[model samples]
Target: MISQFFVLSQRGDNIVFRDYRSEVAKKKDGQEEAPPVFNVDGVNYFHVKVVGLLFVATTRVNVSPSLVLELLQRIARVIKDYLGVLSEDSLRKNFVLVYELLDEVIDFGYVQTTSTEVLKSYVLNEPIVVDAARLQPLGPAAIFMQGTKRMPETAVTKSVVANEPGGRKREEIFVDIIEKISVTFSSSGYILTSEIDGTIQMKSYLSRNPEIRLALNEDLSIGRGGGSIYDYRSLSGSGVVILDDCNFHESVRLDSFDMDRALSLVPPDDEFPKRDNLKLK
Candidate 1:
């Protein structure tokens, strides 16, 4: 996130600072630009630069790289904890968003272990919930916040006989299959929360596991009734899913009445398989 700071004077002069950094130049004008100064509210000041502000802002931001990695790890950890077991395929499924969030933090100048290793470790060991409020509701109940639609399906039942003819119970197969599936789940509620610093927080349960690897033919919606709100289709712990056609209304706003083109954030069709990965062991 791009941050900005201001240097202001009480009378009327205000200085806004954002980033900070070191200088490498010959001593010109007999001095080094007074460390790139700025004025605050009326006082004449200097010694401020985008890079310098960045340093100060980073300290103030206080979001450590390790914390970011830990968060990513915890996301995977949550899935494992809830499922009571872990699988490499499952880890791979959820790593997409975890990696994206980690990249967001890395752009802020912090570093952590590779996202893959972090997820691996998380699966091996449960992650410590940093903010209970962030994880207020425990178990599957917490994640399933919205109502879901029972997509129509054709279930077929069959049984297979064992090779040994002595006397073995046949294996039965229950196939709840469908040619087209539309998993309709929606959430319109939020939980009020706050960080340690009293930051206003809002969270909601999602009725879908957003982490499953699937090819969504549409872009993720963000706001209310936007279809991509919590992004349940892309995260872990979201419940049952179905593949369906994706269409968008022509008339809609992007962000607060801002004119922006809707971009397809979904992965390419070739990148995702045409079928579900889950199968009975």
Candidate 2:
């Protein structure tokens, strides 16, 4: 069976996460200014959490839809292979959850692309295996399965030449894998705060319960090979903040932004007051 895949890009303003309930007032000139946000230098730091995945399936075959199922199965196999560390039963359950979640995302206006040539089909594979007793009988179980037939080969046209010789662009395999299990994944994120700034913020997949926290006060310095503070002066005010919790239990991997690599973000004078400047203005 032939499978057509497309990659998802983190592009456009259409896919935005705005949780505000109340609308901000617009200026009389009709220009709405962006709301207050922290500036990391010149750019705003936006935290990203995986809401869900979206699958846009377009049937290119003129007569058969067998490949769509094959494509979905391939996606499921990849996810199960790479991310299946749980028990057999739990793995299966989460695989199904991914299917259901992607379905829900597609239904909730996630796929806003306008491609009339291809018909859109939403498959929510969220099976109610858990709490099965809570499910009410909508009708006869066999009757509900009536419409899910494999598309016949007669319905599709056979091997028509593409108008463009290059054909369509190929999608990234990871994106489809993400979309395939989008419904089932729950993100485990953490709140990161700086002691010097008293700032609190959250980030997905960063670990709420870290395995370690290294407090780097003024004059205190650390690095992999005992690098000196003068060697790190090029880093500016950025410093590392470490937390020791089970979540981030991995060995120290420091860079320009992390704790082991540089000095604390506090200004040097503020931390160690100069003797000449000790005289109050």
Candidate 3:
């Protein structure tokens, strides 16, 4: 769980700060805060520097510290993708949308949703006029201020407005499977070591929440239509590309794949690598 979140500038200035904890224990009886720097006595911090900003998250309890850093990295990417860059000026200019985004990305230190496509659907690229009607609820239980929400009186580009429906377009998807093979030979032309690396990348422009499944064969041979059909036992004597210890994208359903060896997923808009590397020895 996240206890506190902060965005500081290169000069160590607080750009934006959010606290998930309802009450902050004072350093002493009357002290309003701890030392502003990341290193306080007991608080554990995980921060990453990105684009002239110090993205920091503080946690009072023991938790996976790397998760906070990962969340911050994703937030940086989302902001950069939506606002063009991740600078103090951009943060100030688009503070409204930034706040809205942070609320959507995380809630009470638990990751809510970091899907850029879904976020982009609601978060536009222009300025927003925060109003009762424009500030749409992300969902019944998504990013919202606990007590009350007051949008900052900051100006974004007038062209970018939230809750606009122009982004709803029919999408086209493309999939690419890449493999690289390298072999080393001795002076007598005797093979020393040969290795293969493979990756599956899919570019999806489909509408929101589309489930996709991509299946491949062990022998890397095409049978009927666009499919790979092979018998592993028969191919044991021959050569076949078997993906071992494969790593998948977050959109992939690992449980389903574990059950039937089918690559099932909800593809993001950008080209997502379905597997990290299919190594061959």
Candidate 4:
């Protein structure tokens, strides 16, 4: 369980804070940077950085480190979904809104719901949009833009609350397939180990919240000797892809997964990893 939650700017200014049980002491000034998870005077702290802001949670009892970190990330995403841009200025301008979100997201140190759509009904304050154009770009791209014109439109710069001229909400969803490949070489330059970690990320802005159907490659095989028809083709080297293992989100339905390699589900309001930990043979 979380005892306290707060947000701090890069300069270490406390932007937003909520103390549920008061089990942890108040943050002191000029606190040095620490690991994502650390202990202080018997209290444990879990934090994650997003858009130059630190989202932190403190607890006194032993809890899952991954769970708390994921909670922090989800909270940050929910805030960004409402504020459009997630910066120190945005959190400051939408103080009330941020508090309302925290209140709904966690009740008395217990997480209730982190979904942005679910919290929309409880949070009434409209977010004060931040000017993305005036803010400096993050990462290596900032160096290249020293003398260039304004940056182009990016996903982070768009506000979810903004509607069209006729007050119609945009209906769009984005899916990104990201993969990281790792290889280890021996002393003789021989490949000792190779693997790929992949995930399917999705973000939805559909108002009606309709069910979505995502179809995978027809020649996809789940394992080396799976019973699927694609398994035989894969063994024959007929341009078939093999996945040693894969995992899907809880919202996914697998009724048609074995037959056609398709997934059906109603996506959440915020961005999330729909499928993850895909291991290729």
RMSD in order of candidates: 20.8, 26.6, 14.6, 5.5
List candidate 4 stretches off by more than 4 Å.
22-24, 60-66, 131-153, 225-237, 276-281
* Each candidate structure's count of clashing pairs: 43, 22, 3, 0
Q: Model 1, residue 132: displacement in angstroms?
A: 8.8
TM-score, candidate 2, is 0.17
lDDT digits (tens) for residues 165-255 of candidate 1: 4544323222232233223333644333211111111111112212222222243222223334244436534443322222232221223
TM-score of 1: 0.16
Clashing pairs in 3: 126-160, 127-157, 127-160
Please say which candidate is ahead in lDDT: 3 or 4.
4
lDDT (C-alpha, whole model) for all candidates: 0.28, 0.26, 0.63, 0.81
Model 4 Cα lDDT, one tens digit per residue, 21-96: 8777786665666999988788998899997888999999899999999999999988988887888888899999
Best by lDDT: 4
Ranking by TM-score: 4, 3, 2, 1
Error of 2 at 99 (Å): 2.6
**Residue 128's C-alpha lDDT in candidate 2?**
25
Q: How much is 141 displaced in model 2, in angstroms?
A: 54
Q: What is the Cα root-mean-square deviation between model 2 and the actual structure?
A: 26.6
lDDT winner between candidates 1 and 4: 4
